[model samples]
Target chain A: MATETAAATGGQASPIALEEAGICVDSHGGAIGLPQLCPDWMGNQIFWLAVTLVIIFFVLSRIALPRIAAVLAERQGTITNDIAAAEDLKVKASEAEAAYDKALADARSDAQAIVAQTKADIKADLDAAMAKADAEIAAKTAEGEKAIAEIRAGALDAVKEVAKDTAREIVAAMGGQADAKTVNAAVTSQMKG
Target chain B: MATDVNGAAEQSGGLVFHPMDQFIIKPLFGDGGVGIFTVTNITLWMAITVLATIALLVLGSSSRSTIPTRMQSIAELAYGFIRKMVEDVAGRDALPYFPYIMTIFMFVVMANFVGLLPGAFTSTSHIGVTAVLALLVFFSVTIIGFVKHGAGFLSLFWISAAPLPLRPILALIEVISYFVRPVSHSIRLAGNMMAGHAVMKVFAAFAPMIIISTGIGLVVTPLSILAIAAIYALEVLVAFIQAYVFTILTCVYLKDALHPAH
Candidate 1:
């Protein structure tokens, strides 16, 4: 308070400057009191404040605010679109995976079917070859039996002839001739017994 | 004078404390009266604040890229912060007024932070500036309330939840408090800014204590400096908090105007 009143005896340089400075600054360019309370500067301060607020509001509303809002909205839209695309890609990828799995399963079943067909074909061929081989062996065994029978018959006939000839030779040597009929009958009876 | 030499230690050299002088509205150029048209420090600082707002809001978002740059992201963050505030506090219906709220937030924040620069004048510290900001909010909210609800806006002062007999008293209190909103709002910001700056100035005045007396100065100067640093950090926090408080309060007031039920 003393400092404020001391300004009454302040510098006598210019009373106008003193009044314009308001009761805020002292003669020595120091603050006499709170400058905020001075009424002289309030008008210009408010005026400038108004100008500033107006400028800021104008720039923000007209340019900055809209620009920022658009950028944000655009960014949001891009994110949403990107997310949607990712979801679509994910669906497609899953579909492809499903298709791949189905293909693999089909190939496996087809391979199994092929293996079964080949096994059946091989079994049929083996059964047919074994049957043909058994038929050939049976035919060869029948022929061998017939040949052996024929040979035995021929040997029996030869034995009968030998008996008849031996009887004739014995009869000639002993002065007694035997008949062929009698020799044949004796040989037949002996073979039967 | 007794003012300069209050203490005996002041007798050595004149100790003048011009803490309030930083707030004096001086013309940027020559000595002149601060007429409404006169270009003062207020204009300069306010212009700087305006430029900063433009730089952050306009130029920063020029890319409009989905992958935002730092400046763009900062701009977006500020926008989203205030937009969400207006949406949450004032309701979605108040989105049309978002730009206005955004302007207030950016200006106050920029003015505060910019004013923290050394030797800089704090515009928001002055009642002249804060009063206008507060009054703008006050008038706009009131007008919007009346426009939206007509006489129904008065319901805000009438607490429907209160007992019928006590309703009148509560309404009276509400009306008075509602009227005091501008005063409190403006004073809250200005007082915070003024108090912080003044306290810092007082601390700074002690920074030269060593020049006064090496004996007392040795301890006092370092302490004062440390106090200044500590207060500076606090002031930085106060600066942002005050701006947030001002904007959020604006949003709250706007909500009352929009709803006005209780």
Candidate 2:
């Protein structure tokens, strides 16, 4: 192949011949094409150095760098917009969170109020029932006391009538000798005492 | 030996030396493509490109605020952009692989951009550099595929998209496609870089000649400048495109690895 020949020829060139030809050669048998390439390691170093420098410098200076800078600038603008948006959202979220907590507290108090109202209503009902029972008990006690006083008065009147009848019978049985006048006097005296 | 003095003279002043020629750079050729190839320039450029990218990213990302400053915002945006790219292409499951994708994007973009700098080396122009990157992707995808899919990963080659009669032929083609990934990946980058630089060099060689020839040659100077500018713009576009392409391909390859279908 052409490449193989070039490689072979390029490898076999002697130092003196290469120098005469104004080419610097490396020990690896490759001739440095440009006179700018020194015969020492310096030559090889310089050649590649120039090639690298040229390519990097060219690409960066002209194309890649500008595009990158443009992209960066655009991205920066977007980020600023995004940060501003996020801060706004965060503030809104905090307000919403506070409102939510307040609403929850209100809801809890409303529930407690309902519970307290229910309890008070139940207690009122219970107290009314107890008061009614007490009134009934007092009425029953007063009625029973009136009935007892009437019964006691009736018993005393019955005892007084029975005593008069018995005494009259006893006086008659004892007399023929026992006169009505005497009996009446004795009974009247006893009654008087 | 046949020596043509006229041809030599014609090419003599026209030749633009490599940027690394300034330093005592050494070349190491592996599976040689351009006869005797050295990677000294490649290594150096890669180092500088990486360092520059890191410095920019680090400096940019170091300061973060609720209302980001210009540099901080730019850095965050780049980070988020690459993050979104990975998420979109590779899916949420590939979130863990963000670091790799980000790194690849930064390195490729940096390499491409660095080539635009005056007298700076374009690391991606060399086949060896691109090849290594491509090879790394190839190996990584292969390993991940095998690990995730086990022996079933082999079934990926047998996709039945082709007609039943041509299934075997199609499968063979598929296999070859998989093998050709590294070549295509590397060649795309290397070829683009080489062509762009070569054109620029050819134009640059005329600048001095134009100057030496007095005002007569000066007419070409504007043309040269214009050509350089045009090429520079193209290189910038190429840089972004190459980085995107490389990242996208990585996503696709990773997808195949994580989810194999027969």
Candidate 3:
């Protein structure tokens, strides 16, 4: 084939140059016939094909494929871990909210208790003060009543004495006999009536 | 056909370009027959495919980060995509073959995209390459089926649900289809890749041809360029789809192998 191509090239200057340059210028019905008819080229192609394919297979099975698989797996792991972390954080946040709500309820109850106790204490103090004031007023009233009764008794006695004197004088002026005891008795009876 | 075109183009005194010339295999070093040891363009491109795979998968995922870099994300995307595909289509038992399926997907997709570059060879375009791949899947599935089900694996072709009289005919058809899997599998990939690349080349060849005639050149050149662009876009989609189809089909076959009852 080389000699034939060489001889043909000698006759044709352009084809020879193209042939020498490794450009397939002979044009044996394009690529269709070469692989089927040329035993030499076919055998070489198959040989290199096996070599390259084997290399590729091993590289993929051992090195390339495993690496890609690992990367994918690692990415998946990261995603799952992130999701789990988010879930845990969510649980913790709920717990904190629950604690906050409980604390608020406790503080409210404590405040209510304190208010109720303070109110009771203030009421007790007010009642004690009221009782003391009532007792002092009652004592003053009793003293005022005693003083008035004494004054009344003294005045009544004075009035009786004056009546007795007047009655004695009248009896002397009218030239009629009148004793002091009788006059006193009569005045007392009138006052009593 | 190529020589005839070349002769006619020569007689016309126009530039004779061979669009199919890119598919030829020759030695990379010296002028000689391509032996099993000769390094050819197929070897070179296939090596590039391997290196590209390594770069994207091995080195790209070396970081193994929780927050991925761009390359790492791409690597991880491919990993998850193929892993899920295998698991979904082939079941969880097919997970053991995940690496192999992933390797095929990455290699074919990378080879196809790389081939789209200017002046680059598409190794997967060759039946020689695709056949080996398909054959590997074929043999693996068969072996796994036998190992798993023993004589029961043959029941994969037997349609018990069919009418009693149609069972034998249906089984025969199923057996033929089963044997034809590797052929169709390999040809589908190779044919699609070859056809897309060849169409692009044909459109490109026309772009230069427009220069031969000024009046037609004005219209044809722009049209050819536009056509090339359109086809190139479609080829990009084809590249991904072919790879996907190949991998998914492989998973389906693996499923059949693992559970051949249906």
Output the number of the TM-score-best candidate: 1
Which order, best to worst by DockQ?
1, 3, 2
Tens digit per residue, CA lDDT, model 2, B1-262: 1123323444675433332232223344442322123454556676688567656666554443445677756656666787788778767888777666666667777888887788777766666556666887789889988987899998788776667888788789989999999999978986787677767776766666564565756788778788888988888898778877877888888777777784
Q: What lDDT score belongs to each candidate, Candidate 1 first?
A: 0.86, 0.66, 0.83
Candidate 1 chain B: worst-modelled 10 consecutive residues by lDDT = B1-10
Q: With candidate 3 superimposed using the best TM-score fit, by how many Å does residue B81's alpha carbon deviate from the native?
A: 1.6
lDDT of 3 by residue, B1-262 (tens): 4445666777886765555567777677876767787888888898899999999998888877789999999988889999999999999999999989998999899999999998899988888889999999999999999999999999899887888899899999999999999999999998898888888888887786566988888998899899999999999999999999999999999999999987
* Strongest candidate by DockQ: 1
Candidate 3 residue-pair clash tally: 0
Task: Summarize candidate 1's per-residue lDDT along B46-116 as a digit string, tens digits.
Answer: 99899988898889988888888999999989999999999999999999999889888998999999999
Candidate 2 chain B, poorest ten consecutive residues by summed lDDT: B17-26
- Model 3: residues >4 Å from true position, as ranges? A2-40, A132-193, B1-17, B208-218
Report the error of model 1 at residue B29, Å. Answer: 1.3
Q: After superposition, how far is residue B203 of candidate 2 from its true place, in Å?
A: 1.1
CAPRI quality level assigned to candidate 2 from its DockQ score: incorrect
